[model samples]
Target: MKIPIQLNQENLQEVGSRMPIPDYNREADNTGIVHIGVGGFHRAHQAYYLHQLRQLGEALDWGICGIGLREADAKLQDIFNKQDHLYTLMVKHSDGKIEPEVIGSIVDFKMGTKDPEPVIAQMAHANTRMVSLTITEGGYNFNPTTGEFNFDNPDIQHELKHPQDPKTVYGFLTAALKRRREAGLPAFTILVCDNIEHNGDMMRKMLGTFAEAQDPDLAKWIAQEVSFPNSMVDRITPVTTQTDIETLAQKYGVKDSWPVTCEPFIQWVIEDKFSNGRPDFEKVGVQFVPDVGPYEKMKLRLLNAGHSVLGLLGALHGHPTINACIEDEVFKNYLRAFLDKEATPILGNIEGIDLTDYKDSLLERFANPNIKDSVSRICAESSAKLPKFLIATIHENLAIGGSIKFATLVIAAWCYYSDKEADQNGQAVEIIDAMSTDLHQAAEQTKTDPLAFIRQESIFGNLIRNERFTKLYSEVVHKMYKDPNIKKYMRDMISIE
Candidate 1:
């Protein structure tokens, strides 16, 4: 099929597609939100919602100005620049239906490598009342053990010393807020859209730690002025591929260089706290609440943690994508047992949320054949992800004397996957973690002594000292190693009959 028109601000009125395009005036829209980490999730979710409001003529000022920090971001900067900051979002439903929309919320963007000065200037600009972030779970740079900002990190140390010539995000935020202070400008509300549990509070601590290292006075000013509202954002956006772009052009009649494909479902639950007033996101189905704690915990324990379980086990079983994992009975049954027997016991109640229904919804989402969500993507950054997603459930289960059968399996499955060059079906399993070198080395050491992996003090932190956990983990790892094939062993171990 021939492409109808190139997706751009100039071609929206002329483009023919099954879905909608922004009819709002782009030139008249002013930038109100400077989003750090312009990636797939931010574009598909928050940016999509903002575009909704923009189309309604309600959010003319909340147009997004995206900022890309890393060197690789230059690719995206060029992609957006060529398209006039308009990209297509193709929503894939579970039933195999596709809905494509052209989003025009991102009015401007700055590449940090090209000119860091403009990013700071726009961030400090009076129109920029809020700074939102989707920089992934690990980008916050907190010490895993200490639960504080890792000021001792070499990059952070450099930023602390030279605040003006900043590199780390903390430094940029610190410098921008300082400028706001001197100029008597009201500090922007810091909205954290990451997956960290108690995200707002954790962000406050991290940013506050950065500020304190710079100047005690500035630290105090930030603590008093800025509002870091905790938020729960849920969407399964797979990494974009060139194939996705080609398919969009072929099937949807739109030619997009870099388009984001996401599931039809999307949800954002935010705490009602903003230093500077926020946009009318509630109009677009954003849940504004008095407290985001319950919602945060629910999503973390069930969705994020559940993803980790499926991710590690799926990889070990030689499944490539999440839907592939869902297709297997052994994995799906084990996941349900983990949720019902282990995770749900420790979970506290969230107001108006039906836990059972939520769990069912997760199963449906995970089983969505259209999403094409990769197990490898979910398995990436295991060092950061496992601690956030799985460790909490382990600690809680162990403390309460709940059966850790599933937690043990979760860790054991990861160990089993890491200890091999390829998964059970001879599919290559890449260990992708920032700490992969050290973690893989430790995993290799565990071949001799099962305790080597758990002995990483920064990650385990005295958890190995627990007699029950240690015994169970050792037994699980030893059993996993003794078995010649992982699939047969997992069948018996998880009781997958």
Candidate 2:
């Protein structure tokens, strides 16, 4: 089957057999939201949801104008621009079923590499009522353990120097909000859709700090007027590959320049607080509540924490994708035992969710064959991820006097995997981290001294002081060096429960 033409709005109607398209009356809709980090997850999740709203003739004005701040984003910006800010979202089912749709929630895109002025201008527009972000875990510019904005980062330093022609999101946002304050316009609802715990509050803190450094008056006004609502979001969207683009054209008969692939599951739970009005997201499957704290903790423990357990071990074992790790009985059992014994006892309850059911569903999603979620993807930014996803959980378990076997094992795996001197199957280990050079140097020292890695008080805090965690973590790392048969070692460990 051949697509009649390329996947632009003009040709959306030609691909009806594949699935529906946003062929709605979208010409009059204004851009009410400017989303930063318009990557695969954004396209597969939030943008997809907004596209659904447009399909139902609701909240048409809440369209997204995508913004990309990094040099890497320029290529994506070009692809999105060529496709008229439209792309195909292919839902990959484990049972070998594919559901495809041409999503059109994004009406425009701006790359900060070209010029930050236009992107800031879009945010300053009165019609833009909100600015949503999916800037990943590290983009927040904060030290995970200290929970302080890393103002010393080179990017932040540059942003501080040139506030007007800002390059970082913090710089652009400060400039935009400053304009709004001067013009006597109401501040936009700062909706942060990232995965970190208390993401909205984190954004408000970091962004506000940036503003305060620039203008104290603007910071005060923002603190008084702006609303930052915490939210919980879940989706298994993977990085787009060339195969995804080809598959869409060959199998689905739609030529999408950049297509997102993911499992057919998504969720968004938001706190019910927004200044200057907001959309009724509850009208379309969103959960609006007075508080999203309990819900956030539930996701952080089960989903995010579970990913850390799977990711480090899988990458160290040289499993290319997460599904391969899940296929191993030992790996699957490890996930189940860790969640059931180590994670769940402390997770407690969310009002509407069944804890057992949610855990089972999460394991199933991890094993979803269609996702092809790479362990490296999760393993990236370990310098930042471990503190939030694993260390905090470890500390929580420690404080509550709960079991930490699996959590300790996760730490051991990270310590071993992060080593610059180690190799996975004769191939040099690839360490992707914000502090890669520094982390690798420190990790290299641990190749001989197991406790050397965690001694970085900034990363592990005083967990090194705890005799219990130290003895277990050291023993595991030592065994990793002594035993060459990793497979049997994993089996024996996971057999504990």
Please tell me which predicted candidate would have the highest TM-score against the true structure.
Answer: 1
TM-score, one value per model: 0.97, 0.96
Candidate 2 ranges beyond 4 A from true positions: 420-424
The count of residue-pair clashes in candidate 2 stands at 0
Q: Taking the tens digit of each residue's C-alpha lDDT, what string does model 2 give over 1-497?
A: 77435877666677665677886655524789999999888888888888887788888688889998888988887887687887888999999798888888889888877678888889999988999999888788887767888778787788777888787788888899899888888899989988788899998899889888877888899899999999999899888888888888887778878888989989999998887777767777888888898888888878888887888878777788888989988888888888888778877767989999998899899999888898888888877777877787788888888888888877777766667334345455667787887776766787677888888877898899988889988888788766534566667777765
TM-score of predicted structure 2: 0.96
Error of 1 at 483 (Å): 2.2
Local distance difference test scores for all models: 0.85, 0.82
Query: Residues 316-426, candidate 1, lDDT per residue (tens digit)?
Result: 877889988888887787788888888888887778999999999999999999897998999998888777778878888888998777877778777767667468666
True-vs-predicted CA distance for residue 397, candidate 1, Å? 0.8
